[model samples]
Target: MGLSAFQMVYWKACHLPVEMKHKALWALKFLNFDPHETQTKRRNQLLELEEMQLHAYDSSRSYKEKVKLYHDRKLVKIVFNLRQQVLLFNSRLKLFPRKLKSKWLGPFGIKRVFPNGAVELENPNDDGQQQSWVVNGERLKHYLGGEVERFSKVMMLVDP
Candidate 1:
Protein backbone atom coordinates (compact mmCIF):
# COMPACT_ATOMS: atom_id res chain seq x y z
CA MET A 1 0.00 0.00 0.00
CA GLY A 2 1.29 3.55 -0.84
CA LEU A 3 2.02 5.93 2.03
CA SER A 4 -0.59 8.66 2.79
CA ALA A 5 0.21 12.44 2.74
CA PHE A 6 0.23 12.59 6.62
CA GLN A 7 2.73 9.64 6.77
CA MET A 8 4.91 11.28 4.06
CA VAL A 9 5.16 14.54 6.00
CA TYR A 10 5.86 12.67 9.29
CA TRP A 11 8.56 10.57 7.56
CA LYS A 12 10.20 13.71 6.08
CA ALA A 13 10.25 15.46 9.53
CA CYS A 14 11.96 12.38 11.03
CA HIS A 15 14.76 12.59 8.35
CA LEU A 16 13.54 9.31 6.77
CA PRO A 17 14.26 9.14 3.00
CA VAL A 18 11.01 8.47 1.10
CA GLU A 19 11.07 8.08 -2.74
CA MET A 20 8.30 10.62 -3.47
CA LYS A 21 9.73 12.11 -6.72
CA HIS A 22 9.35 8.78 -8.59
CA LYS A 23 5.73 8.30 -7.34
CA ALA A 24 4.91 12.04 -7.19
CA LEU A 25 1.73 11.60 -9.33
CA TRP A 26 0.50 8.72 -7.16
CA ALA A 27 1.25 10.70 -3.96
CA LEU A 28 -0.76 13.69 -5.23
CA LYS A 29 -3.70 11.40 -6.06
CA PHE A 30 -3.67 10.05 -2.51
CA LEU A 31 -3.04 13.45 -0.81
CA ASN A 32 -5.96 14.30 1.50
CA PHE A 33 -6.05 18.05 2.44
CA ASP A 34 -8.80 18.73 5.03
CA PRO A 35 -9.04 22.53 5.37
CA HIS A 36 -11.12 22.30 8.60
CA GLU A 37 -8.60 20.02 10.32
CA THR A 38 -5.65 22.23 9.18
CA GLN A 39 -7.44 25.34 10.50
CA THR A 40 -8.15 23.63 13.85
CA LYS A 41 -4.45 22.67 14.23
CA ARG A 42 -3.30 26.23 13.36
CA ARG A 43 -5.73 27.72 15.90
CA ASN A 44 -4.49 25.33 18.64
CA GLN A 45 -0.84 26.30 17.91
CA LEU A 46 -1.68 30.03 18.04
CA LEU A 47 -3.53 29.57 21.34
CA GLU A 48 -0.51 27.70 22.82
CA LEU A 49 1.83 30.50 21.68
CA GLU A 50 -0.40 33.18 23.27
CA GLU A 51 -0.53 31.16 26.52
CA MET A 52 3.28 30.87 26.60
CA GLN A 53 3.66 34.62 26.01
CA LEU A 54 1.22 35.39 28.83
CA HIS A 55 3.13 33.05 31.18
CA ALA A 56 6.44 34.75 30.31
CA TYR A 57 4.98 38.20 30.96
CA ASP A 58 3.55 37.09 34.31
CA SER A 59 6.88 35.54 35.38
CA SER A 60 8.86 38.69 34.51
CA ARG A 61 6.39 40.95 36.32
CA SER A 62 6.53 38.75 39.42
CA TYR A 63 10.34 38.74 39.35
CA LYS A 64 10.46 42.53 39.05
CA GLU A 65 8.03 42.91 41.94
CA LYS A 66 10.13 40.61 44.12
CA VAL A 67 13.30 42.56 43.32
CA LYS A 68 11.59 45.85 44.13
CA LEU A 69 10.33 44.47 47.42
CA TYR A 70 13.81 43.23 48.37
CA HIS A 71 15.39 46.62 47.68
CA ASP A 72 12.60 48.50 49.44
CA ARG A 73 13.12 46.46 52.61
CA LYS A 74 16.80 47.44 52.74
CA LEU A 75 16.03 51.17 52.39
CA VAL A 76 16.72 53.32 55.47
CA LYS A 77 14.59 56.41 55.87
CA ILE A 78 16.74 59.35 57.01
CA VAL A 79 14.88 62.36 58.29
CA PHE A 80 16.50 65.75 59.01
CA ASN A 81 15.00 68.73 60.79
CA LEU A 82 16.00 72.40 60.49
CA ARG A 83 18.92 73.58 62.75
CA GLN A 84 19.90 69.92 63.42
CA GLN A 85 23.66 69.28 63.45
CA VAL A 86 24.97 66.62 61.06
CA LEU A 87 28.25 65.45 59.52
CA LEU A 88 28.57 65.45 55.70
CA PHE A 89 30.28 62.38 54.24
CA ASN A 90 33.24 63.28 51.99
CA SER A 91 33.41 60.76 49.12
CA ARG A 92 36.39 62.50 47.45
CA LEU A 93 38.67 62.08 50.47
CA LYS A 94 39.15 58.36 49.67
CA LEU A 95 41.28 59.19 46.61
CA PHE A 96 43.87 61.12 48.68
CA PRO A 97 44.62 57.95 50.75
CA ARG A 98 44.49 59.41 54.26
CA LYS A 99 43.63 56.48 56.53
CA LEU A 100 43.93 58.39 59.86
CA LYS A 101 41.76 61.34 58.83
CA SER A 102 37.98 61.17 59.10
CA LYS A 103 35.98 60.89 55.86
CA TRP A 104 33.12 62.98 57.29
CA LEU A 105 33.60 66.72 56.68
CA GLY A 106 31.54 68.88 59.01
CA PRO A 107 29.14 69.20 61.96
CA PHE A 108 26.97 71.21 59.57
CA GLY A 109 23.60 72.52 60.65
CA ILE A 110 20.50 71.86 58.53
CA LYS A 111 19.37 75.17 57.05
CA ARG A 112 16.55 74.06 54.76
CA VAL A 113 14.90 70.75 53.91
CA PHE A 114 14.05 70.14 50.28
CA PRO A 115 11.88 67.43 48.74
CA ASN A 116 13.35 64.05 47.77
CA GLY A 117 16.09 63.60 50.40
CA ALA A 118 17.87 66.91 49.72
CA VAL A 119 19.04 69.15 52.60
CA GLU A 120 20.63 72.60 52.72
CA LEU A 121 23.50 72.72 55.24
CA GLU A 122 24.98 75.67 57.12
CA ASN A 123 28.80 75.77 57.19
CA PRO A 124 30.50 74.56 60.41
CA ASN A 125 32.92 77.52 60.69
CA ASP A 126 32.57 79.67 63.83
CA ASP A 127 33.16 82.85 61.73
CA GLY A 128 30.37 85.41 61.49
CA GLN A 129 29.76 84.51 57.86
CA GLN A 130 27.42 81.47 57.50
CA GLN A 131 27.76 79.62 54.19
CA SER A 132 25.08 77.15 53.12
CA TRP A 133 24.97 74.40 50.47
CA VAL A 134 22.55 71.71 49.25
CA VAL A 135 23.49 68.03 49.58
CA ASN A 136 21.91 64.58 49.48
CA GLY A 137 20.58 63.49 52.89
CA GLU A 138 22.06 60.00 52.44
CA ARG A 139 25.60 61.43 52.83
CA LEU A 140 24.81 62.98 56.24
CA LYS A 141 24.82 61.56 59.78
CA HIS A 142 23.68 63.08 63.07
CA TYR A 143 26.37 64.94 65.09
CA LEU A 144 26.47 64.08 68.83
CA GLY A 145 29.80 65.68 69.79
CA GLY A 146 30.55 68.43 72.32
CA GLU A 147 29.97 72.15 71.69
CA VAL A 148 32.78 74.72 71.76
CA GLU A 149 32.36 77.95 73.74
CA ARG A 150 33.82 81.03 72.01
CA PHE A 151 35.49 83.64 74.25
CA SER A 152 35.20 87.35 73.22
CA LYS A 153 37.18 88.70 76.21
CA VAL A 154 40.05 91.03 75.36
CA MET A 155 42.30 92.23 78.25
CA MET A 156 44.78 95.15 78.00
CA LEU A 157 47.56 96.19 80.41
CA VAL A 158 48.73 99.77 80.91
CA ASP A 159 51.70 101.18 82.94
CA PRO A 160 50.62 103.12 86.06
Candidate 2:
Protein backbone atom coordinates (compact mmCIF):
# COMPACT_ATOMS: atom_id res chain seq x y z
CA MET A 1 0.00 0.00 0.00
CA GLY A 2 1.07 3.57 -0.64
CA LEU A 3 1.06 6.44 1.79
CA SER A 4 -2.25 8.21 1.63
CA ALA A 5 -2.11 11.92 1.00
CA PHE A 6 -3.61 12.44 4.43
CA GLN A 7 -1.12 10.14 6.07
CA MET A 8 1.73 11.99 4.46
CA VAL A 9 0.29 15.23 5.73
CA TYR A 10 0.00 13.78 9.20
CA TRP A 11 3.51 12.43 9.12
CA LYS A 12 4.83 15.81 8.16
CA ALA A 13 2.87 17.48 10.91
CA CYS A 14 3.88 14.97 13.53
CA HIS A 15 7.58 14.59 12.87
CA LEU A 16 8.80 17.83 11.41
CA PRO A 17 10.05 20.60 13.65
CA VAL A 18 7.15 22.84 14.68
CA GLU A 19 7.58 25.78 12.36
CA MET A 20 8.85 23.94 9.30
CA LYS A 21 6.33 21.14 9.28
CA HIS A 22 3.65 23.45 8.00
CA LYS A 23 5.75 24.36 5.00
CA ALA A 24 6.48 20.72 4.34
CA LEU A 25 2.79 20.03 4.52
CA TRP A 26 2.14 22.78 2.05
CA ALA A 27 4.62 21.29 -0.41
CA LEU A 28 3.09 17.87 0.01
CA LYS A 29 -0.36 19.20 -0.71
CA PHE A 30 0.92 21.11 -3.70
CA LEU A 31 2.55 18.00 -5.08
CA ASN A 32 -0.25 15.51 -4.29
CA PHE A 33 2.19 13.12 -2.81
CA ASP A 34 1.46 9.42 -2.26
CA PRO A 35 4.68 8.44 -0.53
CA HIS A 36 5.64 5.15 -2.19
CA GLU A 37 4.01 6.01 -5.52
CA THR A 38 5.50 9.48 -5.28
CA GLN A 39 8.93 8.00 -5.73
CA THR A 40 8.20 6.92 -9.30
CA LYS A 41 7.03 10.35 -10.40
CA ARG A 42 10.14 12.02 -9.09
CA ARG A 43 12.22 9.25 -10.56
CA ASN A 44 10.72 9.81 -14.00
CA GLN A 45 11.00 13.57 -13.74
CA LEU A 46 14.63 13.36 -12.75
CA LEU A 47 15.28 11.20 -15.77
CA GLU A 48 13.57 13.73 -18.04
CA LEU A 49 15.49 16.71 -16.66
CA GLU A 50 18.94 15.31 -17.32
CA GLU A 51 18.93 16.37 -20.95
CA MET A 52 15.83 18.54 -21.24
CA GLN A 53 15.09 22.13 -20.33
CA LEU A 54 14.07 22.71 -16.71
CA HIS A 55 12.53 25.71 -15.07
CA ALA A 56 11.43 26.16 -11.47
CA TYR A 57 8.68 28.76 -11.49
CA ASP A 58 8.03 31.18 -8.70
CA SER A 59 4.51 31.90 -7.54
CA SER A 60 4.86 35.58 -8.22
CA ARG A 61 4.75 37.09 -11.68
CA SER A 62 7.99 38.18 -13.26
CA TYR A 63 9.89 38.22 -16.52
CA LYS A 64 11.78 35.27 -15.15
CA GLU A 65 10.92 33.02 -12.21
CA LYS A 66 13.29 30.59 -10.60
CA VAL A 67 12.63 29.23 -7.16
CA LYS A 68 10.39 32.25 -6.60
CA LEU A 69 7.81 30.96 -4.18
CA TYR A 70 8.57 31.71 -0.58
CA HIS A 71 6.88 29.94 2.32
CA ASP A 72 9.18 30.94 5.12
CA ARG A 73 7.47 29.16 8.01
CA LYS A 74 7.33 25.73 6.38
CA LEU A 75 10.13 24.14 4.49
CA VAL A 76 10.71 20.42 4.44
CA LYS A 77 14.18 19.13 3.87
CA ILE A 78 14.68 15.46 3.23
CA VAL A 79 17.67 14.06 1.48
CA PHE A 80 17.81 11.04 -0.77
CA ASN A 81 20.72 8.95 -1.94
CA LEU A 82 19.34 9.66 -5.37
CA ARG A 83 20.65 8.01 -8.48
CA GLN A 84 19.13 10.70 -10.68
CA GLN A 85 19.06 14.51 -10.65
CA VAL A 86 15.83 16.51 -10.40
CA LEU A 87 14.87 19.70 -12.27
CA LEU A 88 11.72 21.69 -11.62
CA PHE A 89 9.21 23.42 -13.87
CA ASN A 90 5.87 24.95 -12.96
CA SER A 91 2.92 24.10 -15.20
CA ARG A 92 -0.76 23.41 -14.86
CA LEU A 93 -1.49 20.20 -12.98
CA LYS A 94 -5.27 20.13 -12.85
CA LEU A 95 -8.29 18.53 -14.55
CA PHE A 96 -9.26 18.44 -11.64
CA PRO A 97 -5.80 19.50 -12.59
CA ARG A 98 -2.85 20.09 -10.33
CA LYS A 99 -0.05 22.57 -10.45
CA LEU A 100 2.98 21.33 -12.31
CA LYS A 101 4.98 19.92 -9.46
CA SER A 102 8.44 21.31 -9.20
CA LYS A 103 11.02 18.72 -10.19
CA TRP A 104 13.02 17.61 -13.27
CA LEU A 105 13.99 14.14 -14.25
CA GLY A 106 17.63 12.95 -15.10
CA PRO A 107 21.29 12.44 -16.25
CA PHE A 108 19.85 9.50 -18.17
CA GLY A 109 22.84 7.26 -18.01
CA ILE A 110 24.79 8.89 -20.81
CA LYS A 111 27.76 6.73 -21.54
CA ARG A 112 29.65 8.57 -24.30
CA VAL A 113 29.72 10.97 -27.23
CA PHE A 114 32.17 10.00 -29.90
CA PRO A 115 34.71 12.19 -31.64
CA ASN A 116 33.18 11.32 -34.97
CA GLY A 117 29.88 12.95 -33.94
CA ALA A 118 28.00 9.96 -32.67
CA VAL A 119 25.87 10.42 -29.56
CA GLU A 120 25.61 7.31 -27.47
CA LEU A 121 23.15 6.53 -24.74
CA GLU A 122 23.16 3.64 -22.35
CA ASN A 123 20.15 1.46 -23.08
CA PRO A 124 17.22 3.41 -21.63
CA ASN A 125 15.45 0.20 -20.64
CA ASP A 126 16.49 -3.29 -19.67
CA ASP A 127 17.10 -4.03 -23.33
CA GLY A 128 20.71 -4.82 -22.39
CA GLN A 129 22.39 -3.72 -25.59
CA GLN A 130 24.64 -0.68 -25.40
CA GLN A 131 23.36 1.77 -28.02
CA SER A 132 25.90 3.41 -30.28
CA TRP A 133 24.17 5.75 -32.69
CA VAL A 134 25.83 7.67 -35.49
CA VAL A 135 24.13 10.82 -36.60
CA ASN A 136 24.72 14.43 -37.71
CA GLY A 137 25.38 17.13 -35.14
CA GLU A 138 22.19 18.87 -36.26
CA ARG A 139 20.10 15.93 -35.05
CA LEU A 140 22.02 15.82 -31.84
CA LYS A 141 21.01 19.39 -31.12
CA HIS A 142 17.36 18.61 -31.77
CA TYR A 143 17.47 15.51 -29.56
CA LEU A 144 19.06 17.65 -26.86
CA GLY A 145 16.89 20.78 -27.31
CA GLY A 146 19.74 22.95 -28.45
CA GLU A 147 20.77 24.60 -31.69
CA VAL A 148 22.42 22.67 -34.49
CA GLU A 149 25.17 25.26 -34.78
CA ARG A 150 25.89 24.93 -31.09
CA PHE A 151 26.53 21.21 -31.38
CA SER A 152 28.41 21.58 -34.65
CA LYS A 153 30.75 24.22 -33.29
CA VAL A 154 31.45 22.18 -30.21
CA MET A 155 31.99 19.10 -32.30
CA MET A 156 34.74 20.88 -34.22
CA LEU A 157 36.50 21.94 -31.05
CA VAL A 158 36.28 18.52 -29.45
CA ASP A 159 37.75 16.80 -32.50
CA PRO A 160 41.01 18.73 -32.71
Candidate 3:
Protein backbone atom coordinates (compact mmCIF):
# COMPACT_ATOMS: atom_id res chain seq x y z
CA MET A 1 0.00 0.00 0.00
CA GLY A 2 1.23 3.56 -0.90
CA LEU A 3 1.16 6.29 1.78
CA SER A 4 0.45 10.03 1.11
CA ALA A 5 1.58 12.88 3.36
CA PHE A 6 0.83 16.69 3.42
CA GLN A 7 4.62 17.30 3.00
CA MET A 8 7.16 15.42 0.76
CA VAL A 9 9.51 12.98 2.53
CA TYR A 10 11.96 10.36 1.16
CA TRP A 11 10.21 6.93 1.07
CA LYS A 12 13.37 5.11 2.24
CA ALA A 13 13.60 7.47 5.29
CA CYS A 14 9.90 7.30 6.26
CA HIS A 15 8.03 4.29 4.62
CA LEU A 16 10.41 1.50 5.80
CA PRO A 17 10.12 2.07 9.56
CA VAL A 18 12.55 -0.73 10.59
CA GLU A 19 15.45 0.53 8.49
CA MET A 20 14.73 4.18 9.47
CA LYS A 21 14.86 3.32 13.23
CA HIS A 22 18.13 1.44 12.78
CA LYS A 23 19.68 4.41 10.91
CA ALA A 24 18.41 6.94 13.48
CA LEU A 25 19.82 4.90 16.37
CA TRP A 26 23.17 4.50 14.60
CA ALA A 27 23.40 8.27 14.06
CA LEU A 28 22.55 8.94 17.75
CA LYS A 29 20.92 12.28 16.73
CA PHE A 30 17.87 13.49 14.71
CA LEU A 31 17.09 17.02 13.41
CA ASN A 32 13.57 18.39 12.57
CA PHE A 33 13.00 19.98 9.11
CA ASP A 34 9.78 21.42 7.46
CA PRO A 35 9.40 20.05 3.87
CA HIS A 36 6.60 22.56 2.95
CA GLU A 37 8.79 25.55 3.96
CA THR A 38 11.74 24.22 1.87
CA GLN A 39 9.54 23.70 -1.26
CA THR A 40 8.05 27.27 -0.93
CA LYS A 41 11.53 28.82 -0.70
CA ARG A 42 12.63 26.91 -3.86
CA ARG A 43 9.43 27.98 -5.74
CA ASN A 44 10.04 31.68 -4.86
CA GLN A 45 13.67 31.48 -6.05
CA LEU A 46 12.53 29.87 -9.36
CA LEU A 47 9.97 32.68 -9.94
CA GLU A 48 12.69 35.34 -9.39
CA LEU A 49 15.05 33.56 -11.83
CA GLU A 50 12.31 33.43 -14.53
CA GLU A 51 11.59 37.17 -14.10
CA MET A 52 15.32 37.98 -14.47
CA GLN A 53 15.54 35.92 -17.70
CA LEU A 54 12.54 37.73 -19.21
CA HIS A 55 14.06 41.14 -18.38
CA ALA A 56 17.38 40.15 -20.02
CA TYR A 57 15.61 39.01 -23.22
CA ASP A 58 13.68 42.30 -23.51
CA SER A 59 16.86 44.37 -23.02
CA SER A 60 18.73 42.33 -25.68
CA ARG A 61 15.90 42.75 -28.25
CA SER A 62 15.84 46.57 -27.78
CA TYR A 63 19.62 46.77 -28.17
CA LYS A 64 19.49 44.82 -31.48
CA GLU A 65 16.75 47.14 -32.81
CA LYS A 66 18.88 50.21 -31.99
CA VAL A 67 21.90 48.72 -33.79
CA LYS A 68 19.82 47.87 -36.91
CA LEU A 69 18.35 51.38 -37.02
CA TYR A 70 21.83 52.93 -36.83
CA HIS A 71 23.14 50.68 -39.64
CA ASP A 72 20.15 51.42 -41.92
CA ARG A 73 20.62 55.16 -41.44
CA LYS A 74 24.27 54.94 -42.52
CA LEU A 75 23.60 52.83 -45.67
CA VAL A 76 23.59 54.65 -49.07
CA LYS A 77 20.77 53.94 -51.53
CA ILE A 78 22.32 53.13 -54.98
CA VAL A 79 20.17 53.50 -58.08
CA PHE A 80 20.64 51.94 -61.60
CA ASN A 81 18.65 51.71 -64.85
CA LEU A 82 18.50 49.53 -68.00
CA ARG A 83 21.13 50.09 -70.79
CA GLN A 84 23.27 52.29 -68.45
CA GLN A 85 27.05 51.72 -68.59
CA VAL A 86 28.81 51.01 -65.27
CA LEU A 87 32.14 49.73 -63.92
CA LEU A 88 32.20 46.55 -61.81
CA PHE A 89 34.42 46.58 -58.70
CA ASN A 90 36.85 43.59 -58.50
CA SER A 91 36.72 42.23 -54.93
CA ARG A 92 38.69 38.95 -55.42
CA LEU A 93 42.23 40.43 -55.79
CA LYS A 94 43.74 39.28 -52.46
CA LEU A 95 47.46 38.51 -53.09
CA PHE A 96 50.38 40.98 -53.22
CA PRO A 97 48.66 43.02 -55.94
CA ARG A 98 50.44 45.62 -58.14
CA LYS A 99 49.80 49.26 -57.08
CA LEU A 100 49.05 50.44 -60.66
CA LYS A 101 46.69 47.50 -61.55
CA SER A 102 43.12 48.66 -62.16
CA LYS A 103 40.63 47.23 -59.58
CA TRP A 104 37.56 47.89 -61.79
CA LEU A 105 36.73 44.96 -64.16
CA GLY A 106 34.20 46.26 -66.69
CA PRO A 107 32.35 49.02 -68.44
CA PHE A 108 29.50 46.53 -68.79
CA GLY A 109 26.11 47.60 -70.01
CA ILE A 110 23.11 47.11 -67.70
CA LYS A 111 20.67 44.58 -69.24
CA ARG A 112 18.02 44.50 -66.50
CA VAL A 113 17.39 46.07 -63.12
CA PHE A 114 15.60 44.25 -60.32
CA PRO A 115 13.52 45.95 -57.61
CA ASN A 116 15.72 44.35 -54.91
CA GLY A 117 18.97 46.15 -56.00
CA ALA A 118 20.29 43.34 -58.28
CA VAL A 119 21.54 44.45 -61.74
CA GLU A 120 22.09 42.15 -64.73
CA LEU A 121 25.12 43.24 -66.85
CA GLU A 122 25.64 42.55 -70.58
CA ASN A 123 29.05 41.18 -71.70
CA PRO A 124 30.53 43.51 -74.39
CA ASN A 125 33.26 41.03 -75.47
CA ASP A 126 31.64 37.95 -77.09
CA ASP A 127 33.57 35.12 -75.30
CA GLY A 128 30.92 32.45 -76.30
CA GLN A 129 29.98 31.97 -72.63
CA GLN A 130 27.20 33.33 -70.40
CA GLN A 131 26.01 36.65 -71.93
CA SER A 132 24.94 38.17 -68.64
CA TRP A 133 25.57 37.92 -64.89
CA VAL A 134 23.69 39.47 -61.98
CA VAL A 135 25.62 41.62 -59.49
CA ASN A 136 24.73 43.77 -56.48
CA GLY A 137 24.11 47.46 -57.35
CA GLU A 138 26.54 48.53 -54.59
CA ARG A 139 29.45 46.89 -56.53
CA LEU A 140 28.79 49.04 -59.65
CA LYS A 141 29.65 52.69 -60.34
CA HIS A 142 28.60 54.98 -63.26
CA TYR A 143 30.88 55.03 -66.37
CA LEU A 144 31.27 58.61 -67.69
CA GLY A 145 33.73 58.32 -70.66
CA GLY A 146 32.68 57.83 -74.28
CA GLU A 147 33.80 55.07 -76.70
CA VAL A 148 37.44 55.69 -77.83
CA GLU A 149 39.17 53.79 -80.72
CA ARG A 150 41.63 51.11 -79.46
CA PHE A 151 44.29 52.05 -82.19
CA SER A 152 46.84 54.65 -81.15
CA LYS A 153 47.63 57.62 -83.55
CA VAL A 154 51.29 58.40 -84.27
CA MET A 155 52.06 62.14 -84.70
CA MET A 156 55.28 63.30 -86.52
CA LEU A 157 57.31 65.89 -84.57
CA VAL A 158 57.89 68.65 -87.21
CA ASP A 159 60.37 71.54 -86.75
CA PRO A 160 60.11 74.49 -89.20
For 1-160, candidate 1 gives per-residue lDDT tens digits of 4777766877643323455553664665578656588799999999999999999999999999999999999998988999998877766655677777776656778999999888987763456777676778888989888553322211110011
Worst 10 residues of 3 by lDDT: 151-160
Screening candidate 1 with a backbone cut-off below 3 angstroms (N, C-alpha, C), the clashing residue pairs are none
Candidate 3 regions with alpha-carbon error over 4 angstroms:
1-33, 126-130, 145-160
Ranking by lDDT: 1, 3, 2
The lDDT per prediction is 0.72, 0.39, 0.70
Taking the tens digit of each residue's C-alpha lDDT, what string does model 2 give over 11-53?
6433447668788888888989877788998898888886354
TM-score of each: 0.60, 0.18, 0.64
Best by TM-score: 3
Ranking by TM-score: 3, 1, 2
Considering lDDT, which of the candidate structures 2 and 3 is the better prediction for this target? Answer: 3
Screening candidate 3 with a backbone cut-off below 3 angstroms (N, C-alpha, C), the clashing residue pairs are none
**Model 2, residue 99: displacement in angstroms?**
67
